[model samples]
Each structure stands twice: as structure tokens, then as C-alpha cells.
Target: MLIHRIFQVVTVIDCVVGMMASGFIVSVGSTDWMRRRKLPACDRILICLCSSRLLLQGTILHATLFPELTQWNVVRGHSVLLVLASTACLWFAACLSVFYCLKIATFTQPCFLLMKLRISAMVPQLLLGSALISLVSSLPFLWVDYSSHLCNSTRSHLKNISFESPTGNNISYFKGFVMYVTWAVVPLLFFIASSTLLIASLWKHIKQMRQNATGFKDSKTEAHITAIKSLISFLMLYICSFIAEILLGIPSCQAMSRWKHNICSLLIAVCPSVHSILLVLLNVRLKLAVKSILLYMKCHRKQDSAEALWQERKSMSSS
Candidate 1:
């Protein structure tokens, strides 16, 4: 048990760091040339999506490491905030998937205009889906507030919960199951389906390039193709992690196995962490942007030091 808890803690830390890094990359990358004014909607969507990931990971980390500390008022408040953030992230991912499908599969003559006008349509769906999932996941906590010291859903003592209404436990469990289905299972299936189509499209595209190497050797097309492939690989990992989570969630399996929860949590953490690694590799522009930021910071520090020395000299002369 101690070993398992240690593994869970390590995995949670990895996931939190990965999510934060990915969010920063996405946030910074969005301001670069990859997203022009014409594509600002997509930028906004991606930024929100990445930001949600950070929040979700933060919640999970707190649940895993600081369950006891949650007894504090601030921890309790943060727990609720993390849950909301996770639900919002799920909704955003769903919207992103659907948006890609529309752009790739059903490109109409006025698709850009339609995208611009109907982008707002996705906001309500995201809001509604997130709210429903949050309500479901959090319903169980209503019956028991464990002083925020234990990880989320870490406690097994049902009797200590003082506010157990007759149906609350059942409702809570049901809500949790629903969130597992909606956020993890359903989206996973969608990712698999969409990714399958993307892979097929990429295969056909590559075949065409092979047959007409001279005509299709444009650098932009090659780069776009590579980006698509990277995205599909990331989606595949997401699907695998989700499937692992679903398998671990089986009632019989969880009941029979003491280590199931930690194992599943570790598997789930692998997705975002692996994704962070890939984003660093695939996004050349992001890599350069980070280098530039570091360079700028170094130069700014030197300038600050120079200014301080000049200020001292002027002050001494004035005296």
C-alpha cells in the first residue's frame, strides 16, 4: 500500500508538471504566427482547452497528496474549483474534436464564415456539459466533508459522513459513474473514431505525395502533414489512457483489487504527461519561442543590473 501510494504521488506530480508546461506552451504558442487574426477563434479554443488541463491536474494532485489538508476552508474551496476546471476542460476537448471534424470532413463554401458565426454555438454546449459533469462528480462529497485532509475519493469510511440523506450515497456514486462515462469513456470513443479518420486521410495524403513527389513536395504541406500525424498520435494516447481508466473502474475489478485505484490513476496521468513531451517535440515554433523568452529574460536581467549601477553612481554624485 505504501509503495502504491508513493507511485500515485509520483505520477500525480508528473501529471501536474506536464499539464502546467503544456498550458504555458499552448498559451505562448497561440500568440505566435500559427494563429493569425483569422484563426483567433481556434486560438481562444485551444488556450481554454490547455488551461482547463492545468486546473484538472491541480485538482487531482490535491486529491492525491493533500487530502488531509483539504479540511481547511481554502482547500475545500480549491477542490470545488478544480472539479469545475476539469469539467470545463472535458467540454472544451469535445468541442475541439468536433471543430476539427467540421474543418476536415465537411468544408462548405462558406465554412470560414460559418465557423466565425457559429463558434459561439459551442460555448453553451461546453458550459452545459461541464456543469452537468461537475454536479455529478461532486454530489458524493456533499454527504461527507473529510476536513479536506484526504485525497479526493480516498476515504472509505461511510459512517463518519454526518449528512447522509437516504438517497445521497446512491446519487453520489451514480453521478461519479456518469462523469467517468461522459468525460473519460465517451470522449475517448470519439477520439478513437476521429483519429482513425485522420490516420486514413494522412495515409492517402502520403500515398499521393509518393506518387507525385515533385508536385507535392511543398514544405508547408509536409509540415502540416507532420502536425496532423502528431495530433493523431496524441489522441491515440488519450484513448489508451481512457480505456485503461474504464477497465480499472469496473466494480468487480475495483472491489477485488486493492491497488486498482492507484494503478488507474497512474495510467490516467500518463496521457497528459506523454502529451507534454510530444508537444515539446512536435511544435518547433514553440521551442524557438521558449528559447527566445529565455534569451530575453537574460538580457533583461543584465540591463536591470546596468541600470542599478548607473543609478548608484548618479546618487553618489548628487550627494
Candidate 2:
């Protein structure tokens, strides 16, 4: 029980960090949108990604803090929304990876060139389609018996989660399996493909750059290297979290001991927080924002310390 509580605290902390990081992404995109009255293609996709992830984190926070509320009728609706949000997060992430691949990868293939040329125009449609697909995938759950399947415990990590039909109904389990494929596996495949292409393109570009007479890495080479590094890290993080989520949502896994279940849940919760922070560090503008914020905070703390020192000196002199 002590371990369970500790795990819950850790999960709560993860959700809070995820929420803050996601909120930062949303604020950055929203500020740019409001200021310019227009959003760039990447920011548009990012906004959608953050929004869905924010929803995912918020729902997790609610469940983590209020595990006992899982039995409530209203929790069913929230669970369904959580599934939709989680699905949308996966889709938007796949779209973002594809977008990055198109923007940065140099491929002479006609299809690749055509996609690169048109990806900006396709961003809006892709965003809409992602949400629509997630909605359609999640609609079947509205009719399923929520209590029998979704409200499995006092633990909220998997509350209202997808890909698990109620136990003993082979047909429902089949439905759950299909939804899981559509919701997660498909996006994972898409992401893997995009990352592979992007990495290959970067490697080829670096090899060519090395052959240049300058014999020094240029800015473009550095940029490509940075992107490749980011993509690889993101890819690994995402794949691990994806596997953890699959384990968490499995019906058989639910019968496992509490500590094992909590461990899996913690693994699933890490992706949003870590990925959002990675995005901040990877984007030039967002990195600047973070640096400025940190600098200001440091200055403010120094000012407070100086003021306290002066007050102490004055009090000593007075004595």
C-alpha cells in the first residue's frame, strides 16, 4: 500500500510536468498565432499535438488524484474522451514526424519531391483528419458497458482506457484489438517509416558534406545532425512508451500485482513530459523562450537575495 501511494505520487508528478510542458507549447503557438493572426505549418501541427497531449495529461491527472471516482457514471464519458485524446496524440505525432521528414529530408524521388512541395498545404487537412479519425475510432466505446470493462479498479491509470473490451467476450476483445491497431499500431508504423527516411537522408547528406573540399562540417550539416539526433531520441522514447501503453491496456495485465501495474503506468506517463521538453529544446524559437525565462528567473532570485542581504546589514547596524 505504501508503494502504491508512492507510485501514485510519482504519477501525479509526471502528469503535472506533462501538463506544464504541454501548456508551454500551446502558449507559444497561441501567442504566435494571435500576434501574427496566422500560424505556420509546423506550429499548426504542434498546436494540435499539444492540445491533444494536454487533454491526455489532464485526464490522467484527474484519474490519478481521484482514483475512487472511477466508478462514477460521468467518469465513463471522461474515459472515452481520454481515449480519443490519446489516439489523437499518436496521430498528430505521426503527422509531425512526417512533416519533419518532408521538410528536412532531401530526396530526388518524384513522389518525395511532390510531397515536400505540398506538405505545407496539406497540414491543415491532416490535422482535421487526425481528429476525425480518432473520433471515429473511439465512438464504438459509447455503447460498451463501461462498468464491466473500463472501471477496473481504484487505480486510474487505465481508467476509461482503450483496446480492452470487457473480459470474457471474445467479440468485444476483438473489437478492442481492432481499435488498438487503428489507435496506436498504425501510428507507430507511420512514425517508424518517417524516422527511417529522415535518418537515411541525413546520413547521406552528412557523407556528402564530409567529401566537400572544406573538410569541415557546415551549418546545414550541423542542422541535419541535430535533427537526426532529435528524431532518434524521440523515436526511442515514443516506442518505449507505446509498448508500455500496450501493456497497460491489456486485460490480462490487469490481473498482475499492484506494483507491476503501477510500474507500467509510470512508463506510459513519461512520454508526454519528456517529449514536450524535447520539443522546446529542439526548436530555436522555443529554446530562446526557455532561456529568456530562465535568465529572468535567475535575475529575480539574485535581486531577492541582494535585498535580503541589505536588510540584514541594516538590522545589524541598527542593533
TM-score of each: 0.67, 0.85
Estimate, for each residue in 181-259, the C-alpha lDDT of model 1 and write its tens digit. 6654565565566556555656776676688888546674566566576667777766666666566544343332546
lDDT against the true structure, per candidate, is: 0.60, 0.80
Clash pairs (backbone) in predicted model 2: none
How displaced is residue 194 in candidate 2, in Å? 0.8
Best by TM-score: 2
Across 93-156, the per-residue lDDT of candidate 2 in tens digits comes to: 9999999999999999999999999999999999999999999887765654443344344544
Best candidate (score: lDDT): 2
RMSD to native for every prediction? 6.1, 4.6
